[model samples]
Target: MDPVVHFELPCNDRERIARFFEQAFGWEVQMLGPEMGNYVVVTTAEPSAPPPAPPHAVPGCINGGFFTKTPDMPAQFPGIVIAVQDIRASMKKVTAAGGQVLGEPMMIPTVGDYVAFLDTEGNRSSMLQPLMPQQ
Candidate 1:
């Protein structure tokens, strides 16, 4: 199963949203620069710790981010991102399963190729095809 590995919260004011989360939940928010779309990364737990093994493990302390709201984007609400092994195959599956794939995937430097989609219920979600490490 594809697990939700990340999340995103859209906000009109990036700094304000970051401050609110920091004050309310004590989450660490790092605002990225223009080259990175000014996205804010919220760290809810220790980044160095590995996720617990499955079957015996329940998800806990997953980190997320806040993105600047854009008028042109559809389903601009809080969304979860699922990590996929193959983006092209996943995109095909999304359409076959009655989900609407929003747009072409874009490369995120040192991160992955990412894209968003709207599920059958109209809820927006994202998927990431992580960049493989170079040998």
Candidate 2:
């Protein structure tokens, strides 16, 4: 089974967007790596879910983050990526389900492997599988 682990944000001015997020939601922005063009990752320091407590404890919390991309990248590849166990199998299912592959699957360097495709509704989305080997 697969799940959505991260989401990318397509922005024209990364700094401006980062500032807006910081000021608007108190989201901590940590600029990762060198600014290679306008592509960057905007991360919220907050945890995805509140620290798990006993079953009787209070409810958990959730947060979000960003990954900047060249304006064109988003058009070519939407900012959303869903997790998958088998990329090839998923692609096949996507096609069988009336979807289409936008482009070939590509490795995302240190991040992971991803492929872009259109859902049955013709909306752009991606599927990703982590590069790390399971223990």
Candidate 3:
């Protein structure tokens, strides 16, 4: 992939979050796995649209949903993150957009560069750039 173009949010209730996105932005999601237990890919449902269509995905647009892990299986889950091309550039925009940086940007060996930030509404999320491939 060129970069991370997708994002998913962990929710206590998949259906609720799904519905929120649906009603909020008119996103049609296809649920996978048994009884809505798998991933939900967001898509558009306009009849005039082409098949295998991609939804208008972005902030204030469509979003994915995932079931939250129980306390007993805390180790099995992780929070979702937003991908960015340049972590440093993203941090500047994030701050200018009325968000506060939670911590300094630092690199994780063999992993990526990242930093956490809180939106003006106090919602927390991280902007990250995956490590460059070795030559």
lDDT to native, each model: 0.85, 0.62, 0.60
Q: Any runs in candidate 3 off by more than 4 Å, and if so which? A: 1-79
User: Which TM-score value belongs to model 3?
Assistant: 0.42
RMSD to truth, every model: 3.9, 5.6, 8.8
Candidate 3 C-alpha lDDT tens digits along 36-124: 34656655334333533333223344333455445743222333457678888888898899988777877844547866677797665
lDDT for 39 in candidate 1 is: 95
| 1-135 per-residue lDDT for model 1 (tens digits) | 887878899999999999998999888989899999899988776655345322112355467899998878788999999889999999999999999999999998777899999999999999999776555
- The positional error of residue 9 in candidate 2, measured at the CA in angstroms, is 2.4
Could you arrange the candidates by lDDT from highest to lowest? 1, 2, 3
Best-fitting candidate, scored by TM-score: 1
Global lDDT of model 3: 0.60
lDDT for 46 in candidate 1 is 66
- Residue pair clashes in candidate 2: 50-61
Local error of candidate 1 at 134, Å?
A: 5.6
Summarize candidate 2's per-residue lDDT along 6-40 as a digit string, tens digits: 55666656688788988997766656555434354
